[model samples]
Target chain A: MATIMMRVRQIAGIALYLGLANAQEASWRSPVNVLSRKGLVADQISTIWWFLFSTASLVFLVVITLLLIALFKKGQAVPKGPVQENSSVRPILYLGTGLTIIVLLITAVYTFISMRTLAAPSQKPALTFEIVGKQWWWDVRYEGESISANELHIPSGEPVHFSLHSDNVIHSFWLPDLAGKRDLIPGHPNSLWLQADEPGTYRGSCAEFCGVQHGKMNFTVIAEPRAAFETWLEHARAEANAAVSEEARVGQAIFMQQGCAGCHSIRGTAAQGEIGPELTHLSSRLTLAAANIPNTTGHLAAWIVDSQSIKPGNRMPSQKLSGEDLQFLLSYLMELN
Target chain B: MFRGALIIAGLAVILHIGVILISLERVKAKPPLAMPDTTGRVVSQEASSLLKHYGCGGCHYIPGIAGANGKVGPGLEQFANRAYIAGHLPNTPENLVHWLMNPQRLEPGTAMPTMNLTSTEAKLIAGFLYGYDNDAR
Candidate 1:
């Protein structure tokens, strides 16, 4: 029996080690990463989570203790029958009810405080932006600027107010490390505010199910210093830089001549199709196809050649182009920044 | 209870068989149509990528290309035999190349958008399409 017990302990230790190793290999996409807070809202959310956890744990312990006591004392009761006054049971019932009521009241107060804190607008002038939730992508536009897709940039230590809209169905925008979820409904505009305390990249996803590709509808929130953000904004507002190389010029010519102009738009060029995302500063983005893959030259070539293979059922169709044409197009796109 | 279980089991088997038979019948009921054979022409290896770049599969059904199953426009299985381009222009190599390069200039308000293909790119795609003609001897 002792040998068997030792073997069980060794097995348990191995299992625990394997579990830890697996957890370490988990990517940023995992929900387990939500424990790290980066913004003011997430801080409050974490506090609330701890409070609820402790309260529930205490209640569970108390209930389990009472149950165990009752079960063990079942045979030890005196033979006084129905005539005896059960004073002990009455006090326990009163205690349980009183504790439950107090816990509920505390929870209610916490929820009220958190909601008010979230709803209160920042006193300092917050940067205003609009984000439209499409079928499986987020169309983001800074105030009075051309639109971009899948990436949201904000200044650190400053509040940013977002006006959210939906073009087709309802989608809930959620940046777990920055703020809670907000629903974007068609014909109804909702507003949300977030203030990141640090300059870092936070990933977000469409929390609500919209369609077949809802799981793939991910985005990134980049928080930088005020100076850097302003510089980025200026760059975003500028027209596409002229192609400096011959290959890029050929690629630009192909982009304009092809049906790409029908769905995508690149400012300062004749390619003005509103069906897809704006591509004035396409190369500056970190990821493509709504964070499906890193924005590399190879990924760009593959995406341009066959976007359906990268993100199936997406609105962007595959383009049949020769290798030389694809190289030129890739060069042109990479130079957009 | 034993008899009731037997009846339920028997009914479930019958229902499962009925569903399979119905599905088989539906699959067999599709009508077959006489499709033209366009296997004679040599398709350029680069034509597939060019076709994808132009997004031709988004509107027309092109055979032998993945994701070319769009139904927005007419299928291009035997396009070589078609006498006119876009139902009006005469079906010549020059006309096809011209139509590929400038769809809007030839016919404004047409559903097909102008896919600015260069002359060389357009000629290559046209060649690949024309090579698939079944009637060509």
Candidate 2:
């Protein structure tokens, strides 16, 4: 009997663990849901939102009840005739006005208190990243470090600072589940603090109406444990892996010679152009073209050959490469882990 | 009846002038092309229109182009008088044409992009720049 009881307990524990793991995975996939906040700043914001929502709902319910009473109550019906100076009418007006003032005052105080808490992080940020907004992509980097595009990584349970700037037009940095929207204006840098309570992935996007591809300007933030984040940073800082196979080697040569090097950069190689995103560790990223599409082999090839069809009016013109050369280039790019 | 006719005619004239002025403001002038000068360079207005079409005014401030007051790149007020194209290549017409066609070839890491201009388009743009410079002088 004792052994059977222990076995049953073990099975229950395993089931509970699986349930929690499934819940965590599901929450990450819920994109930009403000109420499902996973960060410190977002927690505060959602608290305020819930407070306001409930208060407003209560007010609405009360108002509707009063309206129904006024409409249907037989003896208490408001007089349609003007200047009757009814005793009941005067008291209702005063009561309604007083209640509105009191509710407004309470809401104002609650909102101000909640807003003040968001001004600074609970703890000092261990890492600060400079996030630059371009025409349709995000450039994430630390000072004097290697650059990554459209994806950000931060350690959970601690604050992360971000200094935002725009290279061209005004763009807004908004991670709805983590923090509020902050504008990145050219010639004017802005700063924000965000913290994730748990390790998960959150979707972020440009909130401002920038240009044609504004809707497609999306990014992902991956929150991990401190040790895992450190490992990632070390790997990302290193140069790209060298092409090994013969086809990949030929692809690397074609990339250098065929004007691809003119726009993109692959560190430790001759392709040092900085006009577009760095391609040093392209294979490791989750998405492509500012998170417009999945980072798959087929999508990468389509993007290379005809990026305009995927995203019209973007800066990358469709390349006219031979089928063999394209295959080779794809192989080489895939090796950039 | 005569007085009403005169008033209607005056109002029509004023409306016509207003329409013409509004159109002039809305559409930047696409003037006719001028003949090739002594230097064998053909001055084409189509090239000036092309500058607007390609949104070059979003970066470079070309003279005499309306709404071309972008502060990203240096102003092209006297482009012909510049000694070097992109501060490196000599400012000859042939070199300028080549630079326009393939800027990355000349300078590997320039912020100026390779716009994939055909040879003819590059020549026309070069002609316009030189012609505008001459006019400014």
Candidate 3:
């Protein structure tokens, strides 16, 4: 029994640790790594929490011990009425109450201060992002350009403030190690902040259930050094600004030939539909189908072949295309450069 | 006081255990939710019926049928006649065929997934679509 309890505690601790996402620490099946300064902050906060919990527990144990002693002591219970003037109880009451208030006030202030410290508001506002929560996926936008689907790469050591919102139901964005949880509501916007103190990747998941694929709706945050992040951002901006390539040009014609533009978007192309995530940087994303499948040609093909198999009840419909058409379209997507 | 407290705690524990057991039994007795319609894979039926079965009518305003109305997808009444699938795809029969057969194949980045259907089934469904030309307006 003791071993079982210890195992449970160990499992829970690992779970809590994994819950904290940092970019460099590559967790299980996670593309992001936990090697970041935010990991340190999370550890610090966890320690503080444990310390406070232990202290309060000690106090509770001591009080309970006193109560048990009082309950079973040698004092003869005089079957009495309401004693008006209890001499010993009054001072003890004042002392206990005073001590409790002092403890509460101190602990409350400390917690508040720690939270404020964790919520780092930058002096210069180095980074900004808009995180949109859909049925189960995330639509992340940096500055004016939007990168669809799974991946988020930001410069290391820069605090990024995120404005989170939802399209349909309410969802929550949580990267426990990086910062905290922020809710995404349909009509309103909520905000949270996180910054990787070093170069790393961190795993994040939907803390709130938006729909059927909520459990599978996970994303990553990559905290790259200044140069790497800048290069990535440059590529993203280029993808946003780029025109349809020659290789994809014929495929683009075919894209319209098939009426795919009705519900999807590719910047600089005729497909500007908003019902779906932007495909401007489709190839750059780590996963497709709102994070349900990994972003690869075959998986993309399978998901496109059978979406219900991947995410049941999503609004997207299935289409039956010829193998040649499928190849051309897949090529066009891979050529999203 | 100690004896009384012990007796009360024991009774509370017993009641709590009983309630937990009863709740578990009640939960186990309930049936599961019905399996969803699998017609998403079947496109041999009429496009109208398929749309109805799939609940596309709930959010889409299909044009040909007078009563079939929904706002989810673009109004499909003249959707068949539209020149493009998403925005820029030239509305052509073969193109619509491709679009119908597999939309994601053409637009790797679109939010619309490739609805599971054989190429022939897509072409057959596209057969009912007639409004892609200028006459639908």
**lDDT by residue for model 2 (A1-337), tens:** 3444544554454344434534432233344688777889988888888988998999999999999998888875456767565675788889989999999999999888887888887678889998998889998888855468898789999999999998799999999888898999999989999998999888899999999999889888899999999998888888888899997899999999999999999988999987788889998887777876556554576678667756678889878777568767877998888
Candidate 2 per-residue lDDT over residues B15-34, each given as its tens digit: 99778655554323222222
lDDT of 1 by residue, A163-279 (tens): 898879999999988888899999999988888889877788999999888878988888999999988878877888999899799989999887888888899999888778889
lDDT values, one for every candidate? 0.73, 0.75, 0.62
TM-score, predicted candidate 3 vs. hidden true structure: 0.58
Steric clashes per prediction? 11, 0, 48
Candidate 1 CAPRI classification by DockQ? incorrect
Sliding window of 10 residues with minimal summed lDDT for model 2 chain B: B26-35
Least well predicted 10-residue stretch by lDDT in candidate 3 chain B: B26-35
lDDT measured at residue B111 in model 1 versus the true structure, 0 to 100: 49
For model 1, the superposed segments whose C-alpha errors exceed 4 Å read: A1-32, A76-88, B1-137
- What's the lDDT for candidate 1? 0.73
Cα lDDT, model 3, residue A294: 44
TM values, all candidates: 0.63, 0.64, 0.58
lDDT tens digits by residue: candidate 3, A125-237 = 47778898877677778775566556678787766778888878998887766766778998988887666677765668888877777877777777889899888877776
In terms of lDDT, the poorest run of 10 residues in model 3 chain A is: A21-30
State in Å the error of residue A95, model 1.
1.9
